[model samples]
Target: MKKLLTAILIFISLFFFAQSRPEIGGNFIKSLFTDHNAEKAHTYFDSFVGSQISVNDLKELYPQIQGQMGNFKSILEVNNEKDTYYFYSDFEKSKLDIQITFNAENKIIGFYFIPHKTFDKADDKTALKIKSDDIELKGTLLQPTQGDQKKLVIFVHGSGPQDRDETIGENKPFKDIAEYLLKNGISSYRYDKRTYSNPETFNNQSTVEQETIIDAVNVAKYFKANESFKGYQIIILGHSQGAYVMPKIAEKAQVSKYIFMAGNARPLQEILIDQFEYIHKIEPSKISVEDIQNIKKQVEFLNSKKFSLDSPTSELPMGLSATYWKYLLDYKPLEAVKSIKTPMLFVQGGRDYQVTEKDFNLWKNQLKSNKSAEFKLYPSLNHLFIKGSGTPSPKDYEGKGNVDEIFLKDLVQFILK
Candidate 1:
């Protein structure tokens, strides 16, 4: 999942448009994704598109989406809200919602593609209950029904309120990874993130150490104390934000190995700035100078020593409290990893836009001398470890794809070693 800066970009857009025009907008979107022909779709944008974008640009963008979401299926639903029309369309691989804003003349003025969330049916057989203090968390454990488990891997989620499956749009990358590990004779556990299960428990005062780290430590302890897992080695597979804090968890828990997937070594506030700058550079037409300035102001507030839990959250990015940012700023993943002695595997996606190749290199440069640390980089993979072509946009995460099989193979070897 992306951090504050990226989430802000996802939810907000500027448009110089008027009332909804579903018929025109819907057909226009269909023509772009369904026909996968830029030349044919150009007519729809002729009068609407400004000098900032051209027909050839629209053509290139549409075909790139086809590469990610396959062919479009049909429009599932449509809603007219405010001055915009929202069309939810089914694609061969995933469901995507397109929002189109029109000018007073019924010409399209703005367009956006958003991933639609899909909930999976509950599986009772894999369900497990975990108790952390007064709170009980529902989780799932995946393992071969008839085989002895060689190792147990506990999945730690990235930022956000994630379910046990870490479901993103139509893809459940964690579930895919667990199933693959189970087939290879490994057992894995994943639970609904604390924030997802108990939102009321978290407030502006809550820090990552309190909200995330403590619960992860408890989960590890719970498994280590279980009689069923007595003979198996314990592994902590931390992804993104989870990976950033794995070393801290290792300090408090008894885990054999740590797998960092799309993890970052730099401070989160710094990474957030990097993400904003990168996106602004890539999509200059979409990102306004005012937007960039606003983000910079937020970054300045985050870096200020006077910032505290009581600071106004309205000015902060991602609607998170100053306390949360303070905690992240205080923690240094690279320094934490330096002190950790446990065997480590850092897995990175070369095409990941959120946590880019720069983070992976930081890890390598910091831990290269450590004999127990290893690294793997997949050039085509994104933050979720799903393979895709070209530069990975957030839309690519909506596509139906599994965690790369090659990563699973490597993970199996790491476990056995």
Candidate 2:
């Protein structure tokens, strides 16, 4: 997920260190993988890192590479881009790619372990256009060839500039979901995200309402106004960040039901902190004093009261504008859910690292007494609702997979009921 990668990049880029040195970057990465001692490796990597991830986070992630990929072999290739270095390496079990970004002083400010590659599969698709206010976007409408077109679903993507397929690398999860739904006598509508279609519009000031909610509202209205959809039961299916904001979307868009897939009840920034800590908990090791201090400083900034619409991007996480953070901080998904009277279904994956079971439990606990709400948990599924074995990693998304059949069935049942 490019959006996921961008978020991580933002988190790591906050540390401003020294200038780039190819030898320094290469040696630092080599030492981290070969040393076999996270503490010792931290000494080498920490000095290069300004402060983006906690030493604990690195410790947990470092070993997982060896655990999954086996011992590192040799660096197959290295590509340099400005102050950043991209290293392609071979492991006993598989290949891995690592990216390191450096500051002017040659210190490491960003590090990333990219997951495996994704491949695209061909599917039958129908072209469509979505219009709202001055925005007109391209999209696809997928449906079963023989069905009565009784049920219609709109897929709203997670954060970032996602296309109608919600494409990540070669994988198109939304397209897969839509096709699966079509096979089951359901119709779906998916469009290129507003940001993807019109990046210039968001160059200046923007809010969640402007960027996402309005577009969603327009989509629903378009479907409703069309005579072809007159008798269909309309559903809004949101994934990840999309799910997080669905409740708010419901406030403006009149729809038959809502589906929240891997959604979080907590604020976005708070969830990010939890995600960082989860990375650390999975692997425990001694961290350097400097790294610990850096993590503390970063957390302090997120928790401070100094943030406002006018706050500089440098003060915010990922250098996002103040307007963006202010909207996320002020908008509470769970609070919005409390006022929504529409029937809702929550689906969660047990192995999902991004939006974990904790978030699922939060929704369950909050909506427990509401008979209008239902929940489903897939213990073997990842964030994309794709079933897999072993501990789920970002690599799981690299392969071709469909939304769990049971999940699609449940979703169909919910829409018809």
> Which candidate has the top score in lDDT?
1
Question: lDDT tens string, model 1, 1-417?
Answer: 469877776554323133237777876876777666666556555363755577678778966777777777889887665677768788777776787776666767788885432222355677787898768877888877777556999999998877777778787888898988888888998988888777789988898886778888999999899998887889999999999898899999868999999988887767777777777778765566777788778878877876777788877876788888778877877888888788999999988989988889999999989999999999989889998997667668665788999988998899878
**TM-score of every model versus the real structure:** 0.72, 0.68
The number of the candidate with the highest TM-score is 1
Tens digit of lDDT per residue, candidate 2, span 190-252?
888878767778853888777788888899989999998889888999999899999889988
lDDT of each: 0.80, 0.76
After superposition, the stretches of candidate 1 with alpha carbons farther than 4 Å from their true spots are: 1-123, 284-286
Q: Give lDDT for model 1.
A: 0.80
**Cα TM-score of candidate 2:** 0.68
